[model samples]
Target: MIKFLIKGILRDKSRSLLPVIVVATGVFLTVFMSGFLKGIFNDIAELNAKFNTGHVKIMTRAYAENKDQVPNDLALMDVKKLLSQLKIDYPDMEWVKRIHTGGLIDVPDSFGETRGQGQTIVTAIDMLSPGTHEVERMNIKKSIAKGSLPVKQGEALISDEFAERFGVSLGDKVTLFGSTMNGSMMFNIFVVSGTLRFGNTILDRGAIFMDIRDAQLALDMDDAASEILGYFKVGVYDDIKAQQLQASFNTKYSLKDDEFSPQMFRLVEQEGLGDYLKLANSAGTIMVFIFVIAMSIVLWNTGLLGGLRRYSEFGVRLALGEEKKHIYKTTIYEAMLIGIIGSVIGTGMGLGAAYYMQTYGLDVSSITSNIGMMLPSVYRAEVTPSLFYLGFFPGVIATVLGSALAGFAIYKRKTSQLFHELEV
Candidate 1:
């Protein structure tokens, strides 16, 4: 029976071509859109983790509340001891110290006079520590648009754009004027070892990077850090595991009554990211739902039109003693076969496109430059294991559903009335 249906569909292009084309196009879009949306949301999460938040972050309760203000005065104290204990307690995670401070960078001329100055946000990390992966994690080496990574103490990297704007160059001395952790005025000079462009507009605007040790000296934060970031050794954020870790660590170390006590926060819990993630997920789901419904309606119309066109044919089959149920069932089987074939072809094409996109992303720097967010310049598609079957939901089930609805008319035509219709 299946062979006969296949041969019939092959012989008659009108019976199979248009519906197959519609199903294939819908499936292709479904797969591609799913991959694209997944890529965008995943990039946002990963970028935040690598640059700002870790999979988990540890900070003083006071600092956590005012983290947006970059309040270094409320930073974690005795960080060295806490870091050592965290490494011992959570061997599966990598721990690092980070300091977030904002101040002015003063560029000096040959006469030791200030040539230029710019307000800057500084991020200090464990760049000089042996066996540390912060450099690779942040893509600092690749992002260097000029010079090289800092090799010695008191050297830092500034944004290439900031350097250009201030007429600064490599080997220039820049004075950092900022307040210490104790809220005291402080000034320190640093050599410009390199310039970088992180491809994020917000970070590349007026940002500076320095070693955590240098920041400690400059900010009077010895054995202290604004925040201690913890990342899974696997370099991926696992929300459930992170939540479990946060709960356990808070229970053991954090004191709700003590503002100075250390507290742990999962990635989603910080920076209003939990809401952002929820919004992204909701948007993706709504987009997919809209596409499916749109495609289903179009396919349903196609099935209805095809069934109407075959009315005379169905009437002749009934006159030849064929049961209405058999004819209806055959139409459904044919639609299923068309759905399967279209889904396979469309999934292959969509995956190929997605793979290419993932390899070489689409650049949207011009569009995102003015936007004050941490989004990357390039957009890529993320083809997951689910994408292999994601298309079948719309391709197979929707097509079959449309055909089932259209086939109901098969049982409505009476054999006695078919003779009168056939004559007309």
Candidate 2:
């Protein structure tokens, strides 16, 4: 039956091409979008994982409120002490690190000087130690133009964007002058040992790195750190564990903690590109509907008269004592065979599109670049098995319905009462 159906359907190639085109197009679009969403999310996650908010961070609540909030002195919020104790008490925490402030970097008389409120933020970091593995120790140091990641006193890494803007090069002595956490002004100079490029315009434009101790001294942080950064045992990580740590802080140190407490650090969830989620799902639905509707109209006209033209075959077969059921079965078998083959081909094309996207990603930026309009660039698009499945099912369903309807209505099948007409 399947072999016969295949031969019959292929014989009338003109009648079956429309559904194949529709299914193939739909599959391509689905995979295209899926690839774009994946790339953007990965970049964001990489950035978050490298920055201070590794797995989880416990900080002064004020820092959470404002990224610019530089508590001049490290205020001992019991939460910091408690997190330290948990690492010792549990042997499950990776060890906590402290951070203090980010101030405007004041460059001396080299190229351009930051006299007033200029560019740059001098954030304090303590994890500049060599051989540190808290987040794989992102090697922004290698991308440096002047110096390396700050580990010692009087050494600062300038952002590449800033260096280019000011014409500062590697190994140049630069001055950092800004107000301390105490609101008292201070000036410190360091050798430009590293210049790092972030690929992002914003971070490269004004970001600067300094040792935790230097930042504390420059900002008058005293013995306190602005916020406590944390790393946990490799296996003991994730939201649930983060929540448990949060609970421990709130339940154990809520009252005992003075300056810092539950309000301090948020459960540092990694940033991911979730922009695809914002796209209207109805968009795909509407496109598929139009495609289906268009195919139905085209197929209906093609199949209707086409099936009626086969009336002579049905008439002769009936005269030969072939039952009506046999004719219907043959017609359905032909239609399903065409539908299944087209579906297989369509699925293969769709997966190929998905794999291509996995390699190069969607080019949405072309829209912006061509039109000169401001648009957010995305990397990978969101994809799922369901999208391909959706495409294949519609082709099969439409094929069966179109074929069955045409066969049933136009078999030119003579009713017993119509025998006289046939004889005449």
Candidate 3:
């Protein structure tokens, strides 16, 4: 019976072609949109983890509240001891200390007079430690436009754009003028070992990277760090796991009453990101739901129209002693076959397009240039397991449902009406 139906559908394009096209179009949109949205959300989470927050971040309660100020005054103290304890307590994670501050970069001329000055945001991390992963984690080596990674004390990397604006080059001396953690005047000279282009407009505008030890000395923040970042050994952000870890650490070490006490926060808990993640998820769900409903209505109408055109044929079948239930079931089976074929074609096309996007990505640098948030300029689609089967829901179920609704009219025809129709 199924083979006969398949042959019939193959022979008669009118009965199958239009419905298949509709299902294919719907499935394509469903699959592509699912992959695209998933990619965007994942990128947001990963970028945040790499640049700002880690899987989890620890800071003083005061610093967590006023983090926007880069409050080194409220930074964590005795970080070495804290780091040792963290490594012992959480063997499954990697902990690193980081310092963030803002200061002026003053370039000096041949006679020692200031040549040019600009403000910059400075980030210091463990670049010189043995077996350190900061350089790889931030893709610093790959992003270098000129010169090389800092290999010694008092060496640093400046943004390529900043270097150009100031006419600075590798091995040139630049003085960092900033206040210490105690709010006193401080200045230190560093050799520009490399120039980098991070591809982020905001960061490229004015940024500097230096060794943690150098920053500690320049900022007078010895034995202190602005934040302690923790990453899972697996290198993926798991919100549930992060939340559990945060709760455990805070319960054990954090003091609610002491503003200076250390506090732990998951990535989702910081930078108003929890709300953004919720909104992204809700948007994807609503989008898929809308696609399913809209496609169902369209395919439903197509089935209804096809059924109207087949009234004469159905009447003949009924007149030949065929049961209405059997005819209706056959129509449903035909719809199912059409749905499967269309879905396969559509899924293949969608995955192909998504793979291209995932590889090349769509550049949106112009659109995001002014945005202060840490968003990548190129947006890529992500193909996940869910995307493999997401299109089938709208493709198969909607097609079958539409056919069932349209085929119900078969039972409504009376025997006398059939005979009258046959006479006509």
Query: For candidate 1, which ten residues in a row score worst on lDDT?
Result: 287-296
Q: RMSD of each candidate?
A: 1.7, 6.3, 2.1
Q: What TM-score fits each model?
A: 0.95, 0.64, 0.93
lDDT of 3 at 7: 98
Candidate 2 contains a number of clashing pairs equal to: 27
Number of the top TM-score candidate:
1
All candidates' lDDT scores?
0.88, 0.57, 0.89
RMSD in Å for model 2? 6.3
Greater TM-score among 1 and 3 belongs to 1
Off by over 4 Å in 2: 7-12, 15-18, 41-59, 67-102, 110-117, 123-127, 130-153, 179-183, 211-217, 220-259, 263-344, 359-424
Q: For each predicted model, how many residue pairs clash, with residues at least 3 apart or on different chains?
A: 0, 27, 0
Error of 1 at 269 (Å): 1.5
User: What overall lDDT, based on C-alpha atoms, would model 2 receive against the true structure?
Assistant: 0.57
Q: Indicate whether candidate 2 or candidate 3 has the larger lDDT.
A: 3
Q: Write the per-residue lDDT of candidate 2 for residues 197-220, one digit (tens) a residue.
A: 644554566777767667666666
